[model samples]
Target: MTASTPSELIARSRRLGADPRNTNYAGGNTSAKGTGIDPVTGEPVELLWVKGSGGDLGTLTEAGLAVLRLDRVRALVDVYPGVQREDEMVAAFDYCLHGKGGAAPSIDTAMHALVDAAHVDHMHPDSGIAIATAADGEELTSRIFAGKVVWVPWRRPGFQLGLDIAEIKRQNPQAIGCILGGHGITAWGETSEEAEANSLWIIHTAEAYIGEHGRSDPFGGVRAGYEALPQAERRAKAAALAPTIRGLASTDKPMVGHFTDSDDVLEFLAGEKAADLAALGTSCPDHFLRTKVKPMLLDLPAGASVDASIARLTELHEQYRADYRAYYDAHADASSPAMRGADPLIVLIPGVGMFSYGANKQTARVAGEFYVNAIHVMRGAEALSTYTPISDAEKLRIEYWALEDAKLQRMPKPKSHQGRIALVTGAASGIGKAIATRLAAEGACVVVADLDLEKAQSAAAELGNADVAIGVAANVADADAVQAALDATLLAFGGIDLVVNNAGLSLSKPLLETTEQDWDLQHDVMAKGSFFVAKAAARALIAQGMGGDIVYISSKNSVFAGPNNIAYSATKADQAHQVRLLAVELGEHGVRVNGINPDGVVRGSGIFASGWGANRAATYGVKEEDLGQFYANRTILKREVVPENVADAVYVLTGPELSRTTGLHVPVDSGVAAAFLR
Candidate 1:
């Protein structure tokens, strides 16, 4: 195999791609013509092909390739870190080592370049991160990978990532690939195709192990259970309870589903079992920063009214929030930049399903996938005994890792709204009220608006010290009323700096029994009302050169439409998109918009009696009184949500504390938003 006949190794690469066993997207790359001359072949031909970006390993070709000189690429890695320019990084490689055009080398190219192998492949297998971030990550990895791989903890990608990989290869010259804990994989072979094929083989083998050993579900086949139910029933239930899930889900979707029969789901949903299910969340900590830790559990008794269910979910959410605060206070380094918002990481509504939210699809995907895997693991752990979360130290390390903390700070902050006015809707009680009160305390004049005008007035009176506070009465769903309310705010406060569309109502009925009128009513208040308020505020804030802030009170219910509250969840989901759109549109005007989702704010005003806790209590045969303690006890910190806690979040986002923050949702549900079980 001389440099004159490179076709032999290239033909072998093609044959390797044609193999039938390589069905996994878990791909690999290899390059080997004859680096130092095979002892038997006795020629000096070198091959250096990298797997292309964005293609499945199952069907890669020379086109999905970036070829470079093997020895030269390796030499460049040794000194490339000091290079500053893009041209420098690209030019560090030997020009004669080129393979094909239009295919950028793998992002992992630098790592492979430094390794002693002729071929390399990398993949982000589902099971790898799942196993790596969990409490028993090492045990799981060792058991599954056995003697086949090495592991590295989560680290930023790019040059540093590549350098770390190179170091691993240096130590384990014969290792196939290193399992980057909380990240992905890096594998290699003698040939490009063999490296790719080996990667697929290794991951699928592990996938098979997880599939056979993990918990199985009873509600396995159907995507949306009971989606085919009668329209009348669905409408009736929707109308009866749409208010609860407003802005968190899409109530317009005709058929919403719930998870009722899965033994695995039901057991977790079971009211009596908090310890068994309390620790559940996405498999990784980043999911918490994205989706929140815990969810609001909704379990109402058989005969509860829609209002009752709403009240219970609210209560449970509040409890979760309190638990989250305790966790934060316990684990938070006082010197650390304070976390903003009231959104819980994940929301779990027993008997319904789970919901996970994040700033981007990747984050949401991480949350959703983590929940799915966590559910499987939690169920299995229950079968074995009790399940425990990763140690606090491990969780805290990931949660406050320098990189993640830096990301938290990198978000674009709003300017106009800084040190100005704020209006909190539905400020009479629960999370809405908390936000309103907190903003006022944070030096922003606040207008507390709610249907319960008197309660709003009382809340305003209570918050009037640090900043001007006014009570306003208006139907958020009514354009005229909302307009009047806005006018009143402008009249009293001068101009709006921050708008918190936190007003909400709660109702809980099965989709089959939801009513059209009820659905419209809920949407009008939570979704449409929120829009008008924000639009009104946006106009005023954008008028000034400084940016402003708008926050909506969305719920965990948005992530997963829980049982009996599809309408509410749908509306909340819509709110999330609203923030995304607002961020895009308002970015130019310097208006910072975001959300603060509080799980349950039941204790303060007790106005929302029907929420997650009360409902779940009924379902599990526990008394409503027991729900709060039950939820609080089970969460990571065993804390409960308080008006003060959510209020503190309002203070954080509405002030200089989070100047660079925009389009972010802060989950104040303690670690519930961050917990594994959701």
Candidate 2:
């Protein structure tokens, strides 16, 4: 059997895309051309299979490859007026697709089709970009890959770029690849293997040239001692600095923040010339689209208090915004769209590391990853020579490009709670886990907190969306731990919109048999813990000036007495009363507090997992296996309470349905008359 036409090309694309050093998430394109029978005419014709726009090459499938008639795409070159018409070009490219199943062809489809070779690979490899974007890029290109590669000056990518590449090819038919100044590199070959090999050779050759000729002391300074701190302490430090950064970066729309303390980030921040390099520009144009043109440099003095940091960040942010507006006013054309919010997407702090902010976690992480890659490229470029990238004016054009804006405008609509953040306590398993999962499913970023760090992380992993949920180890009974947990939440997701106080232990004992330790543990977790978390969350919400929700998971014992449950009953009642008081006190700040009273949730619950179900069953003279049925019979509706039942009630209270309702109690006990709300 003959080998497939584009399978080798797809394999090569995946190989290159799989490595961030080669391409930063969805940032490159690949193509292959071969003779195939036309589906409609059943005649042999040239077919170009190119990577589709907005698809990641690392995960690209055959469906993601847009098949276009090579002759049809190449013919546009003759009639196309040499003007900047990205919109028309995109429409024309889409119109040329040979089938309806594939997505729109890549913006660079014309350039790929014009290449004489049967296969082409174009990527923003860090090594190639480092060499291609340097101060003397053309001179260095000739010195490194003489005769084998052609150097093309930077031009805005479109019909004109395609024509330029064709002209370059005409001048040098033996050229294996071309380096686009301040952009990226392109390599071509007669086969997919040859193309991939040539691309790797160019990249590795550039890397080797830099390694031999680059500066030895690119980092400028020794590693800081703070970088050697324990992971927990480092995280806490990052958390301490997060609220200030988030507050400063907030614009018309709030931003979510992600902090990084990797060795690459720490080393980059430690460099003496870091500030100067960061100010130059992004390593490539695509990076500018994600992380702005440059990152904001922050100076965090040694041992600065949280308040001092906040004040400093706030002042610096005001100045940054002012400078950004000035830049916009200086360069914005009459046709340019209104300027976006003047907040830096990336922020670099000396001791704490870097923070990337976005409208959500995914965007923020993308910016962070790109910056991390930039660090490597920048260092490599600086070592070889003075690191130089595209000019600020060129970056601004790409940033405000009409076509780029349209891509964002075309995205699907966001969910109801798209940007909201929630913190759920004791979320490693059971009721808390259910609540956390539900909140995430509803489009809210969630912090899954528990006393067990491993279990908490496991629960978060099970949610399977790292961008939407994170795990933190917190013991609600300890005020410091609770505060740290809250800070971590703010650092990870920007702000908290909802607080679920659901971490509690079940203590069902006779009043005389209850030990002091048991009494203290119950009150510490159920009463004092709830108060601490709520107070911390309320303060944050008040600071944000955004109204929020606080839901307490109380029990039926708060309203109806149960035998031998004195301590539990007392604490539950205290928690219920605390909700009412908090509702009244926080009302002015637009913070709502409510309670959910669930009678018996025996399965998949921590209380039951720790033998509480059997204990309660023993107290009622019933078998442990029959406990669920016994409780179901006790309720008027004759139904057993489940974790999901409570989760649904909590959702209703936290969602828009109860926006005007507060200081109220909702019962999820399958219709228990005695525990019913008055």
Candidate 3:
């Protein structure tokens, strides 16, 4: 019945890892033991495939599962008899690796190797941990699970803990699983399926028992009216507070704030017991490593003025950090390295939802997600009975664990734009999409904004990393929509560092033939839209007190008027002038405004998709197919200009290359004499 291959074990690991409810990000590890041919020696050996440290179970692959010699890992129990040997045990785990190259196995590899079952799954399920971390956790497990499970007291995970687990399993040979008090749950069986089923059954049984016996709906009548607001309004409120939160959270190094006002967040914030519930600490000890042991509860007055609100939050943030320092001093081990900064990772602002802070948007977003999960776990535990979690002392141990800190220290250095955030409008396709793609590649988290909501979402998804991009629907013509897009960027990424004002449309009609509607539409989107986006972004950058870049996508027509392109050319000309004006006004704030005037990007561009390419070719008495070559030949270089060419110009302006330059026009037109900047 045992798993004959590692594939089933990998599948089982993924199934549990995929759900945050089952395994909070990187909080669980799984292992399967079987005989395999050693790569170094052509002899049969018992190998244990355990989830490696730093790999998420949800996205786990075979490579992520480290192959260790079972016998080698098990022998480490004797290497440090009676003493906690976390450092030596980690080295032993590395030494036990069966292959030449792969990630180091999870720190719990010893425990996995000692277990009698061939397949074992360990995870911090919210439902299970709620019972496991209770003050009377052992009694609860005995009363509910009875002979089906055994309860083990909290032990720091190490070689000693592995030996303890081995002894418990030896004593209770018939037990299907073990509930580690104040830690998590472990399930095992001869086969992967049985182990997985046993894990699910324990979680479902605990959840069902809680549902039957827990207090009825403590948060039932709480008002969540904030969530009912229009998307624009909701985002505006979030954006209004983001800069202040970011400023308040700042330490020696800058910190970014990510806001989440989802229904769950709103409900949790709206609850009468919100403060009391958050004070209970995280449901699982591992969460303390991400979000601190507990979150800061901010008293955000409803009708306070912006300045008053910022001042109040600033005081609260300082107080929170002071309180954190006290907590650390109360429980910190003298031998532990200097405590990390006392800044709160998760901040709960009643009536405003939650904000999680980190050095960049991705880390902030992950902290926010952990807080959201913590809320769910805490609420469930409270409904059943009084909620209890691991003590502050236990959280201190986990937070400063040498093994975890070592893993972080080993991570590769970040890219050039690692912590920066970029927003690209009209990113659904063409030049905007290219710009977004480039920014993401360069390690900046990107917000894809476009009039087409579905296309924007699809484009963001196509960027291929969920943490690197988000999509928001925004019509550049509407000032409200422009603000909403910026707000969305702030909410998703903490703040905006680079704003690409690239959304525009073309009208290829002569001045005599152009209608009022055509002129208005072109001006509204191209000229006014650029102005609105630049102005809003500048305001945010000034508030952030951080220098920023605003790159506008102008047209070559801005400098050289084409014969039947009055509306498009005129609007683009206005956009170019607006950029210069923005540069002059925002320079004092350390914000730079620049433009890229790209010419005849007929292929793989929105202009062609919107029929402007055919119109221009027809006006020039050429076939539609010849438009690209025609434009390429028009330039002195006689080379076709692609969307990437325009995007490169934007990068140059926004990046360090043009730091001192502003109010400048960079032409991507392959040396057109008349269109050259004077």
Candidate 4:
């Protein structure tokens, strides 16, 4: 029954981590004790393979495990210092490495190592914590498992805690696991399958106990006049307030945001007890690390007007920061790490649901997920008895733990556009798609707005999931559609930072051959469309009170006279002038307006694919296949400009390097002498 294979451990860990009911993302660790041939000694040595710090167990691999020598790990117990020196134990783990090691060991390393078992599973399942955080968690644990599961009081995890658990195991040979008070559940067995089954049994048994014995209304009845708003109204209100909230949250630094209005969140927010419970903060360390100590709850009743809520949020935010500072001052010792920013990671509005913020979109989204886990913990705990988490002093000690601070220091610096949200029109293909992809790569949340919803969605998916990029259907020529896109942008990532007006269509025709329809069509999608997008984006930028960038992807033909491009040339010229005009207008609001005039981007271009390439080639008396080469030869550099070239130019215009430069049109024409702006 001994399942010491590293592969089996990984499979078992993934199985548990995959289910949110088993644990949260990156919330728990799994380990196996086995014999392995040491690389240097070439002799079988007892090895401990445990999941390392800061990786999701569901995505666990052999490389994610920290391999340590069992002999060295056991020997440390003889020299064991008290709990006060627990952090030093984390550093000592490096010396215990079997060889080069697999990954950095987590703080819970000792907990897994000293436990008497061939296999171990530690998880933060909502059910387990629901019982663990109850006011009488020890009694509940005794009753729930009938002595099979023991109750361990809250002790900061380290070497001593591991010793305590090992002693507990020695005293109670029949015990399968222990419920970590105010923390989570830990189970062990000789086999991996048995360990997993034990973990599940503990979780299900706790859940059933709570479900049957729990109060019907865990959070009490819904508050009068605080019912949730209708779905559409709720979303609209969230959209309206997102920018204001984002701006406030970014007081210390810019942050991206995520909004969730799940039924669970809505129901919890509407409950009479939600505000008080949220004020008490979360029970699990995994929950608070991302969600912060306590969420900021709006004072206004549910369904309040958006304006009223907005006015009230400012005052509440001020109070939240002041309280956060006071908490740090009270508990943080001189040895503690510097206080992190005082902004609330989670903001709760009764009717509108929850808003979560972090350095990037994925982080923000995950923070929201953690808060939901906290909500579930509260529900279960309250249903069983009372939801009682660990003390603030304990939470602060863990939050400022030396090992955790070191992990933060080890993280890579933020990317250039980490907190930025960029909207690129006509982003389904060609130059627009390239710009969106480039922005996303540099860590910007992207909106691939296009006329074709399906193609836009595909392009956005290629960039990343909803956390990184989203497809938005928009016809920029329609002012309402432009506004809707901007509103969607606000809801998607809290607000917009970069606007790329790249939606366009080209019609190649001589003045005499140009019909009214051709002229109107080109102008509607390019010149007028650019204006609409800029106007809508400007409004959002001003509302958010965040300075941003507006870029127009014009064309070389706008400046250089080209035959058979009457309609296309006129439309592009219109877009070029609009850039200059908007630059002067938006400068007061700190919004920079710029343009890029690319020589040609025929390859993969939707505009060129839709008959424009052949039309322009025919007008020039050249085959469509040779048109690009002819254009390249005409340039001083004789380099063909592709979609990526345009993308690069766009990046330069909107990037931090050119932060101070605006009202300028950069050329991506490979030195097209005639196309150069005078």
Candidate 5:
């Protein structure tokens, strides 16, 4: 067994963090002590490299490693100001930095540095915490661990806890690690391989012990009427409640939400002790950081009607907020940070499942995952003995610690459109795609809705992962298809905020040459389609009680009265008027409707690529390939209006700069005096 490099430590961490059963997401730390040449003195210097704060071990990298001089870090032991002043050590780590300091050191830095080992791993695995949280955790650890792992009673993580564990290791020479009472676990060794193996041994041993001796039904068996409903009913109920729940959770600030109906959640929610354990809340620091001190549990059983559940949810929500504020008031001191938020991140319903919210989709999803891990911890602990967690007062201490306050202060500022959900029709290509891309770039979760499901999916993948964008199939001409797309939006990222009605096609023909089928097709997809999208979106916006935006991608032809374009022109005109009508009607509800008028978006356009380019070219007596330049030449500025230009107008209308300016048409055709909204 010998010391290793930072990469070795990261590799070991990734292996251990790969499974949630081993550690919760972003909830563990790993470290290694090594020697490197000092650049200035040309002498060897011992260095401590550990996983930095707020980073997931599974995705660790060189930049995510915090580097400090081992001697400087260990020297703090002499100046130790006791447990109350231990938090100051985190700020002191910056002074011990070997060079650029790398990433910010976590509160666990002392735990890794003070311990007498070349390699160490600290994790929040459910199985380990299950033993750790049991009422008789010390006795349980002695028996289940075969006298190898010691029990370090719960102490909020900081410098003092690290010193205590290091002393425990020195006293027990044969110990590999210790179960952190009411916390998690820590394992250490002389080498990377030894350290990782010891961690797995502890985690697996606890799991096996719980399996062999624990009760078969620790959660007190399933309660009648709390069992999960049929799949379809469950899904429908979730969709119906998601928007209202999202709005309530966003009382502090708007949040994106994630819903889970996994077997773990449903099973836990149906158990007789589900309400009791959930109310008791999570034990681990990482778990509570995301899940909060407690979840908002619905009083109704699984058999309750959707309407009754929603109605009761509103009442429970108010009580939850009041209780949270009381907790803050009881524990807050003059030095404590102002209450971060009163809204619960996790919400539980007996029949449906769990919903978690955060500033973004991935965050919201991760919060739910942390809560699931807590459930496992509770189940295992209850099987062994009475499940007990650290006191709420200690929780308040950690939650309001100044170090955490500084960490929050250091987070990157929110994007202009962060937490917004946008649904853009015809978003698979051209102007619609450009709009979706810009909205996502500005930090909105986008739904790429298009008739071509495959292309829509491809475009969404290019934008980003599920957190930023998702593709939904929809034919705007069909009302049911449009509703389905909106439904998908709700299920994915909660309620909708911005709706871009951009699905349209153009057919160039003289009044005499235009056929009845041509008129219907244009009207159906553009005029009626815009109406349906706005109507459905408005309903959701009103239900959420959150103001929103609806931007119609009308055409410059709507006002230009251009020749050989009667059907296409009429539909655009109809869309433009609908925007004005809706804007005036929905003003009271804070829903602003606007229109973007652009002329001749030829390149990369789905409509143009599908033969509208050649048709308009022939109608205007220009070559098919020259159509774009020809249209550009007709504009006063003589600049081609591409899809991106139209997208820019959409942002302006919906962004904060023009928030109060609704029902206004912005022309993106370089300069079309005839098409200007007079």
Candidate 6:
């Protein structure tokens, strides 16, 4: 048989009517076989493999086995399965199985496949099965197997199973195999002879339950549960009901059946019993396969009107749908199954718990199990007056949740520079200074970064709250200084947050006159420095989860043509886009980022005193004095845009007020929207 994954095997077993209680304790394991490194030969060798988890030898497949090199196997006698105490088994398996044929050999597999060897036979003895099926399984198993039987309770299977069994065997050399109640038994030894004997011993022990209670079938007319119905009449009725039922179900064949075991089922199905018959269902839950684990307990009154009965049943179903939606949404993370809107997975009438509708056998099976399991748990719990399982809210969140997967994909992870420390390079004046001053004014401890230490210090001094301001001098164009600036920022404030890419150098030259050296120089300070600050801030912000923001004070020259400023314009445009990509990648963790394009700030401290004012003023035949107003009236708004106006723009972009907006460019250019619109 093709070996399968543990999940597949468990699924198949459930199809064979395996009980969850039995399956959960069956064990979890996987196996594989191939050539692997041989410890003794220092080369590869071939071997047959089996893992410890597949004690159910009949259904075990090659996929459930693990291989070790033949030469390596002999050398591992002392370290293989059956040689160590239970606690030591896992360690030994890990050591011997380390990278062996790409899997760890099952502990028992070692002795069965090689050592005490033979075609190994291993099983959880019948003593365990009987004990586990009994109410006092734990106490009884302990008492009977004190020293002779290796008794292991519910635990993860595979290496652990082998290790525990080995320990038990070590204590009782004559013991056949461990008895795992609820799970099955495993019997293994050299030569099929020893293995067969062990198997017989376990079977003989369980022969008692078989002798007293076993019939042709363990779940025998247990069908007396459905015997009362007139076969011919009910079959016709069910066939007739199929069309209506199938319309609402996903399945083509609706497996219609009845119940008559309980007093309630019998009384309801007898006489003019549509009212009573509606309540019957399965005896136990298989909800892992079924849906909600239990179905509706519908019992219409004998004298009630048909319309009233239908209305009441509909109401009950609606309640079930609401409650199921709530429960599914609550516990499911990203691992639950998909659901159609408002459709209940299973519907139980008082006598028809397992007769729920579905789209397919798998779905029907799922619904059946869901209802059955629920009945077991609920009835059992109620017997003890307890009500507990996963909560409804949890189930609904799982059932209705849309964000678990999409949110992660759509939002970039928030970085740590997100909200802790603020850095404003070139902050002594202009946009940089505005950003630094603004950040300081609004709760952020600010670092006034500038190439001019004196100016930076003066600016910090002006802020007055020195505790929140730090003046640092360094040409960001210098790599060493940039690193030191980062180190200083981190050292001073413990970490960094907002990084305003404000520091910049302006060099204007026509495209033909823009030399490589001149281009590199401007690019180094503006583009390169901005990239460095962003990289540093990204690291710091991600660590904090505070999600810091990065704002670039790119120029409008980044867009429209400007006289004799080719290098600045191209780089500015590129810088604006770079901010866009960063925002895309960092928005997930709550980081908001944006850029500001300021046209002209003649009144800013960063502007040159004589040459800057004169040169710009010469363009429109206006004196240095009327330069700001001349440009103000040139745009659609016809109003002079001030340094303070630009400052306010930056403040707004970085504040909580604009938390949802990012990767946006707000131009502080006295109504330049017309140019773009045109």
Q: lDDT, candidate 6, residue 332?
A: 57
Please report, in order, the local distance difference test score of every candidate based on alpha carbons.
0.57, 0.83, 0.80, 0.90, 0.91, 0.52
TM-score of each: 0.41, 0.93, 0.89, 0.98, 0.98, 0.38
Which candidate number would show the highest lDDT if scored against the true structure?
5
**lDDT minimum window of 10 residues, candidate 5:** 1-10
lDDT of 2 by residue, 1-678 (tens): 023877887889999899887878989799998887777889888889999888888998988899898888887877686575544776788667785688677678878998788898888888888887788889899989987998999987777787788778878988899898888998998888899988988888998988899888776765443233456765666666665576667755777778887888877776777777887758587787888878888665435566776777778778888888877787779877788889888988766678898777888888898898788788888888778887777777888877787787888887656677899999998889999988888878999999999999999988867898989999999999999899889777767889999999877799999999889989999999999999889878876666889999999989988888788888999999999999999999889999999987888888886978888999999998888889999999899988888888878898876799999888888888887777
Error of 6 at 605 (Å): 4.3
TM-score order, best first, reads 5, 4, 2, 3, 1, 6
Question: What digit string (tens of lDDT, one per residue) describes model 6 on residues 238-337?
Answer: 3222222222222222222222123333333232422222222222111222343234544543333434544565576567567546555655556444
Per-candidate RMSD, Å: 22.3, 2.7, 3.4, 1.5, 1.3, 23.9
- The better-scoring model by TM-score among 1 and 6 is 1
Provide the clashing-pair count of each candidate structure: 108, 1, 1, 0, 0, 83
Query: What C-alpha lDDT, on a 0 to 100 scale, does residue 38 get in candidate 6?
Result: 62
Q: How accurate is candidate 3 locally (lDDT)?
A: 0.80
Displacement of the residue 639 alpha carbon in candidate 4, Å: 0.9
* lDDT at residue 567 of model 2 (Cα atoms): 81
Residue runs of model 5 more than 4 Å from their true location after superposition: 1-4
Off by over 4 Å in 2: 1-3, 219-234, 300-303, 487-495, 536-547, 587-590, 618-623, 633-638, 656-661
Clashing pairs in 2: 215-383
